[model samples]
Target: MTSNKEDYLKVIYEENGLERPVSNKVICEKLGIAPSSVTEMLSKLQKQGFIEYEAYKGSKLTSIGGVICIKLLRSHRLWEVFLIRYLGYSWREAHEDAHLLEHVAPERMIDRLEAFLNFPETCPHGSIIPKNGELFENTQLVKMTDLKVGDIALLVRVEEDGDLLDYLERSGIIIGEYIKIKEKEEYEGSVEVLQKEKSIRISYKAACQIYVEKRR
Candidate 1:
């Protein structure tokens, strides 16, 4: 059985990829934990056959662990959708609050939620809600900032939470918005993006955190 912290890490894993391996430092930063604690918990997870942990080489999940993790993520994303759509939680606040709800949710509540929320197919963040908790094969994860001018891409996912995610929504950016990278400033690392009939520019940090799927 995976812990709540493990479930959150799995969200990062699913959004990113297990093949590339994610570092403990990145996990710590995301979860706001100390390095020593991450190391200790990682060691325990490795011993439990949940992950393959090799000191500096980073870590990936075992197939056994990966399956459960994905289901937890499915639960998390579904609940996020419910909170945002029915519960009136903004996309930003929904993320953290959903994390609290996902763990405690029982199948009965999930069924009630599905009925109450009308069986949403995607989260407010625009990620898929797996049916019957189906697992997905891992895919390449690329940040939006890496795109070159004239590149077209699908808005896969945005790295947002708290106030920043709120800003993204206010700026008219959302998942499934087909966008073209119009200009890339190499030095300061800002990128101009065009979507719909309007064009906007966001900083390197923002773009780098917003992952996209290349649409050729």
Candidate 2:
């Protein structure tokens, strides 16, 4: 009866491979709740053996809860990709709609959808399918703003969860394109970058969040 379970579990699941604690404040922000509410739910979760919670510290899933989180996440992401690639929703609209349906997707439905979608290898945003109880390595990335004069880099990925994400997509910055900082604006921090056939100005804030690979 609570998204609290999936919410906490997913946060823990996401942070498991990262080298940092996703602070209670982060969970608060994600859920749009008071900090105290996060603490209250976390306490309940800890008692349920879903996570080990500490006051003013943070939480991590107990092993049993970890397995559930992984399983549910695999289902949600797989369904999201299926909906977008096969069912005609655009990439941007799917995450929120799928968020609701994903939690209730039946096991049989999941299997049928997977088979029908041909068992996608990756989600639309390019996240890998995590399975077989194996932890995934963090994706390789660097801030797009970090490109220096004459440094060659390719835009590898964009973090897809904010107001600015849609804005970036409309601006023609997407994954798998080569980009370089042609000039850094003196009045503002916009960087001039060239994609395929055109050059455009990208704000410093947007550039900083996108990950890029050094050309080698």
Top-scoring candidate (TM-score) = 2
* lDDT, model 2, position 166: 68
TM-score of candidate 2 versus the correct structure, residues matched by position: 0.82
Question: lDDT value for candidate 1?
Answer: 0.74
Model 1 misplaced stretches (Cα beyond 4 Å): 1-27, 43-49, 52-60, 111-121, 137-141
User: What C-alpha lDDT, on a 0 to 100 scale, does residue 116 get in candidate 1?
Assistant: 77
Worst 10 residues of 1 by lDDT: 8-17
lDDT by residue (tens digit), candidate 2, 88-110: 87556666667777788877897
Off by over 4 Å in 2: 15-22
Task: Rate residue 213 of model 1 by lDDT.
Answer: 84
lDDT, residue 214, model 1: 87
The CA lDDT of each predicted structure is 0.74, 0.71
> For model 2, what is the error of residue 180's alpha carbon versus the real structure, in angstroms, after optimal superposition?
3.6
